[model samples]
Target chain A: MELTRRDAVAALAAVGATGGVAVGVRRMQDREGGEDAATDGASAGDPSDRDTNEGTVRATMVAVAEVVYPGEVDGIDEFVDRFLDGRLDGSAHASGLREAVGELADASQAWHDAPVEELPAAEREELLRGIGADTADEDPDGTTAERVRYYVVNDLLLALYASPTGGELVGIENPQGHPGGAESYQRGPP
Target chain B: MSGAESVGDGRSGGDGTTGDDVDRTPVPNADVCVVGAGPAGALVADRLAADREVVVLDAGPRFDPDDRLARRERAIRPAYDRPDVWDVGGERDAHENAGEWFYPLNHARVKGIGGSTLHWQGMVMRLHEDDFNSGTVRGVGPDWPIDYADLRPYYAEAERELGVAGGSGVDNPHAPPREEPHPMPAFEPSYSDSLFAEACEELGIDIHSVPNARNSEPYDDRSPCVGYGTCQPVCPSGAKYDATVHVDRAEAAGATVIDRAPVQYLDHDADRVTAAVYATPDGGEHRQEADAFVVAAGGVETPRLLLLSESEAYPDGLANSSGAVGRFFMDHLFAGAGGTLDEPTRQNHVGFYTSACDEFYDDADEERAPFKLEFFNYAGPSPVEMALSGDDWGDPLLERLRDGYGNHVAMGGLVEQLPRADSRITLDDDRVDDRGNPVPRIEWTVDDRALSTIERANEVQVAILEELGAEVEWVAGPDATGPAYHHMGTTRMSDDPAEGVVDPDCRTHDLENCWIASSSVFPTSGAMNPTLTIAALALRVGDGVDAWL
Candidate 1:
């Protein structure tokens, strides 16, 4: 797109060449092809809300973690909570996790008639599975709902496999946390 | 030959001052001043300390296994990146700035007391007899001045000292005639090894257990391998044979190792090294005068150190009268191929790629560099790597993960790279390491001969995988080169000083009192890793310096 005088500041803001909310608005426009980001629409399950309820997001992650994380490792749910807490170290990706969880909680409330954390174990697993199924069937690039679900499942799996306790499930008393321990050894499907 | 009387032959005489500096700093004394405390230096120091005083200086920390183990337990993966476990600034920083693809191969090198062996997967494969005379037979790189026969006895001694476990002469077609058998029984091949063995048998290729420097049972007070799987980066148990093991033995024999002490330069007069100046960790300087010197730093750094030791008497760098220092840098091109099988064998998740096929080693075709075929088991983070494919999610993802998780295997090669004068390591004018030593600017990349060989190896691996009812997923060409941990050449060995830096005995031609005790003196890097060869050559170097004293 051509950088008009009006779009110049916005274009510069995208790269932090300029600063402030007005510059930020220009950055959003630059990303969205010079459109007003505030007026631009978001699809279902969008995490566009400026303020996220950290308490709800943290609670939902704790409860959902028990059902989604692999293996029946004792204290894994708490481990995941502590792990995610440590992951939120002031980066935008860290902040996006909280937002992603909030969007997911809202989506779960819409689909299963309750937020993910309030649901029982069996129901939570089913909800997460359904979200995963929905995520899998969508475009490989992923939708907002699929992305939210992807973040939830993958984060849980990463944290679980990273822990020493999760290492034992695959006979790796010391799992290379980022390795394909169980997946590489056990043939034909998890 | 007393340590005191054998003071440096430089202009300083017996007093402790260098001509460059006006300060008359008193110099410490040693019969032999060995540079770098890695495997080669430490092992050589063992023999040097028998009757003579020895001093080993290292640029890295002196952290013991306990220090590394604590870091390993704490950091998730890639624990070697931890500050206390690694030097944040050094040759690696230089490699990064130079922007080479092969950086990772040797970038994981450690500077601590143990050297890179601190984190190496302890495989100790011997060089083929034919590997000694590659230039004459295959017309690739220069032949080693010393052959396998000259080194066979030293190899056995090194293996016994390092606690090697393997099927001594059984099944291995290329196992050299040895004076002694392995110290312990060979580790049983993992299920994955069985699959490769079966396929290799049909292909008329021999697959045998690799000679590993790990205790199969307790020997040398070190425990046996507990199958930690995470042996790379850092071995949790003391089972892995590290250079520190020899360093400790050398220390017990009275070879003093001063860690965090980097040698800055050498003071020389005519043909003899007089004084060696070193920078301490605190940015202070110390001078050590010795009767003889052993430059046993790894390939890249050894040449860099020699180049950095330039003086008025030797402006082109010590022992560089032939202009061969920092030239012909070589590393093995790591090539391989693998995929998931149609059906899962019991082989999934086994420790170490135990079997190797060296039948193709010196197949001496006109185009391709001969290579040894190596296989790897799905023991490490295979499960995690497969799951993160980013293609599948939900039940489909789980189903995909389960289908091929344990059914995967790969066969690869430590393919050969011919030494070229153009692919050398030079000093960067601007960038300096923590000690202000000029960092090495490595110039290297893949060549056509290596590429052709890699392709052939890839084709063979794919055919083998298909024969085993596996679907091939990926294959990398041999063209991938550089920064191989098995670094050789640079200050390569030659009978004539006009053609190379060091003599066949590893003593530099220009300097009578200095010798290179590492693979940096290797004229050619064979398909096998350089560690075993370095150990053998280091033994010979010890004897060479002993005669000098």
Candidate 2:
């Protein structure tokens, strides 16, 4: 069976995410990271992200996608989850995805009393904020930090913008998936 | 068409078995062999195909846009910016910047049948009259042998052919004289455009409608632009003018077009290119001889091909008698600024690059290089984008994405980069393209003159942003986009053989039968997009070759 869009490069864009938010709009990590102090997830040798199974990584990513895009990404989480656990074309830099998810889960468990996927929406948001704030200036030139950003934020955004719904948010219809043709100008966001 | 077979992407060889034995055997001679199936080569081949035999070749696939789309989907999972349809995915390294210059040339210019035109945003503009006299008047770079007057007619013709939508006698400062009106009126201005006009007006800056190649009202069998928001990387609809249309025209006019055929060498005897040799995907060679040859293989590939076509007659390279084949390189000095505006402006999200101002070139700067600013109504550093800065994710992320997603507006400019002998393209010793040919290594820089210009642009951007009550989010340095997409001036034209590679007619001084129809022959990089000029020159070069033939 053919791999779905969400399972394809949207998952592989974890490689791109590890670098920065990509597809040319904004790849550079930003400043003004809002972080909350670590309370629970902090542990010796990073005990927060202990579950390194492929399933945990995929589940964490689905939850993370919801956090990144909110209500806009409700229906497409499964395919993205499949893509994260599946193979990717020219996926040169996604090796750290599992570790990245584990890090997020570790942070979630440390801050909350559960893994990242099991954390409450509000807590997940708070944990992601803390991680982003912590990562804003950390590893100014390192790949590990970039990988973290990817696991938490960039990959989800990549998947969102690459999808038909995402393209609609940006005003592109009848794109590569369908036969090419013109439509009435989309004046504003739906 | 001309006894030369037309080969599509699939019909061509695949990997080691890329070429069939029949194709590998000697092919019949074409009257004119045009390298590159992009706009320039396609225009040349189309102009010559009616009377003279022509054959076109491109290093990328030549599937219908729809077919290519299907193939891309079936091959890779769906994603934005998937460039397998256009990007050569091989040896062409981005760019190597040396010296104190901090420019990173990671700009995307394609190598497909339509070249970078497939991904163009359709902001077409002609070079100013003074652009031809930079060498004589500004003493910044070499002057063109022919002036704006010589190119004016061809510009009109090209505008008509490309369906340029622009105002007639809008009386903009710093624009070249036009003999005829634009084929179509300017596209409707966005709400952001009106706001920008008001804001810039308060600061005494004038913004005008930019000429675009996208159809305003269905011209040239192409549909009008439906404002498919994402224009870069690829235009989903055929509304935006790309070279694929002209390539189709060339084929319809009885010219054989070959895809996935990379020209390896040009067989020459002293001053004449006898045949053009190309490599197949399966590691085989296919030679196509022609009475005439036009090298329109884009700025990078055109020069690289010349350097690669080295023989005993010209060890340095073919058409390198003056050693000017790959020197004097230039791209527009690009820089921009963007931030969140005080209020929501969804027009910024829905429109095209429909506005521009050349106030930077309105009054010439004797101290620094001249620049022309273009405004992007759709400029963005969206709230969702800024959320990556670690500000928020859940409710906060939605809030930010909703707040400033459409409220951002920005302006960027292309400053005229004066041609310099030191800023050149030399063959890289180590890196080889997918075809195993040595790629061109660019040694580019911006002097203090350009730095000052950039500093001024930053000031202007800040002023405009502040005028609109927008907070400054990000400011790119002098060369914001690195080298940008407008690659020009490598195989520059000059009447003097010692100082230039091609003549005023775009004929290589070293070889009379060879003509350069690409922007590679630009003597100076104008402060605007170069596609219209490239097409005009290709049409001119087509005439020159036709007359010579």
Q: What is the two-chain DockQ of model 2?
A: 0.08
* Residue ranges of candidate 2 with Cα displaced over 4 Å: A1-190, B1-27, B67-85, B92-106, B171-173, B347-351, B382-397, B479-481
lDDT of model 1 at residue A150?
Answer: 43
lDDT of each: 0.65, 0.66
lDDT of 1 at B14: 22
Candidate 2 docking class:
incorrect
Tens-place lDDT per residue, model 1, B320-406, is 998889888778887777777755444434345577777788685447787877878642234433443354443444455455454
Most accurate candidate by lDDT: 2
Q: Which candidate is the best by DockQ?
A: 2
Q: To one decimal, what is the Cα RMSD in angstroms of model 2 from the true structure?
A: 10.9
Rate residue A161 of model 1 by lDDT. 44
Clashing residue pairs for model 2? A7-A83, A40-A110, A41-A110, A41-A111, A48-A106, A49-A106, B13-B18, B13-B19, B14-B18
Report residue B48 deviation for candidate 2 (angstroms): 1.0
Per-residue error at B285 for model 1, in Å?
1.0
Q: Model 1, stretches more than 4 Å misplaced? A: A1-68, A71-190, B1-27, B70-92, B96-108, B345-351, B379-381, B384-404, B479-483
- The complex in candidate 1 yields a DockQ of 0.04
lDDT of 2 by residue, A44-159 (tens): 14433233644566678878766766564456565574444332111222334556777777778877879887878777777776766334422212354455664446546544
